[model samples]
Target: MKGRLFAPRLVLLHLVFLAAVVASGWLGWWQWERAHEAGGSFQNLGYALQWPLFGGFALFLWYQVVRMVNGTELHRQGESITVPSATGHSESAGEDATERTTGGARRRSPVPPPAPPVTEEEDPELAEYNRYLAELNAAARSR
Candidate 1:
């Protein structure tokens, strides 16, 4: 399978994401109204905005997940995942890509050596441990 998104699993996943988005949005709306109806303090107002923003983020995440699963990349603008850098400028995904590319191909990590064959001589410690554990279990059962 080429992993296309017209399958049963994708349908189930879409349902889950949709439910999450709806639930978060409702919670956010409830919080906002609660703040308004209550004392109307700065803290309450901040909570109101924060909850709505969380709801918005959940919705956006759902959209992105669906798009990616359906063989499409996320189309975003000014979405810089900022790392705290000494320089004021932030690095981007594209910049990382360019930095890592060597010639026309990405560098391949060196393959590790094949593992040695198993031997029975190395297992005496495990056998002793098992015997100790069996002794403890037997003692506990007798008690």
Candidate 2:
């Protein structure tokens, strides 16, 4: 069976989650001690709350780690995300549409024209960069 996976972004989020868990645990520990110093009992009911809350946070973090290891996609952008394409199906049609509608693979433009013309006079800096790139390309090709 074919399966789609978001490998890189998921791994990044897992790392973030791991860091958050460590930070939360350390803060929780620090807070617990601070509470103890303020005449709070560490072995009492008040102290019991800290362990469960911290432990729950740790468990939640661990669950995310497990999901990441199992190749689950993590959506950090607050949107309903689809599985990333493992196959090149979208590379053919989607890329062309993206190029036409959004301009190139980067989507730098908010809305791209169907066919945009290059004008050196309009943007001299970009034109210069383009010329530099062309020179680099020509030199690379000659090698």
Candidate 3:
């Protein structure tokens, strides 16, 4: 863990984070000074307060990165985190794609699968239109 923290890439990251925090603090201080000056406005005071929050957020992100690198995040504690699939069912539930059970009620997709393609003989006009579009696309691509 200590070795990982001091790795070359991590060292660079640490320096960057330190620079961000320092820069934010310096900006906040500058804004605070501006707010007290004769020409200062409420906007300067707002910025003075906002800069510290940015520094605090940077600190939070840095700490989270360190924790993730150390494999100490909550998700790494052998706890299963089930994400819902696009069909609105927990992926880990092992339910069939055609149907799924949610809250003791079976649910299926309201939208049906698309119908098979229509052959040229079945719809000659549509097929001709499609061929025309394809020709136009090919012409555009050649240019």
Candidate 4:
């Protein structure tokens, strides 16, 4: 029974799949015949046969795509979630871990507070230079 999904497109898909298979099989046969007649290297024979196998693979892929579009095939689908870090777990798992460690306390950022800015006065020469610069800036602004 034809479903509403891709009913029109199936004809085109079938044509393309048929073309691919036919071409691949022809190539494989040509390669095999060439190898048999002129003492061609085994490589040609291998490649020739590989063409037909490639065609078959194309057909297989098309079938898979159709099945997937119809919601019939489910393979290799995985569950992945965006995470801030490379801890190999999801946010819920991280929450559980935090609760385990903190005895069910609400989760909070573990980052430390920013350090206090260093004072130029620590170096007398630097402090003097900074004062001079500040005076220059003040004069410039006044002008």
Leading candidate by lDDT: 3
TM-score of each predicted structure versus truth: 0.40, 0.32, 0.51, 0.45
Query: For candidate 1, what is the lDDT?
Result: 0.59
lDDT by residue (1-104, candidate 3, tens digit) is 56778889989999999999999999999999999999999999999999999999999999998988776433333333465765577774224323434544
lDDT of 2 by residue, 1-143 (tens): 01223357656765776677666667667667766675666554455456557757766876866665544322221223233343433333234333332322222235533444347887888778877888999999999
Give the whole-model CA lDDT for all candidates, comma-separated: 0.59, 0.54, 0.77, 0.65
Better of 2 and 4 by lDDT: 4
Expressed as tens digits, the lDDT of each residue in 64-122 for candidate 1 is 87667643322122233434333467654343332234344332235533334334486
lDDT tens digits, residue span 47-138, model 4: 98799889989889888867766543121121222344444554632332232223443333466333334367567776677778779999
Regions of candidate 3 where Cα sits further than 4 Å from its true position? 72-143
Which regions of candidate 1 fall more than 4 Å away from where they truly are? 1-3, 72-143
Top model number, TM-score: 3
Query: Clashing pairs in model 2?
Result: none
Global CA lDDT computed for model 3: 0.77
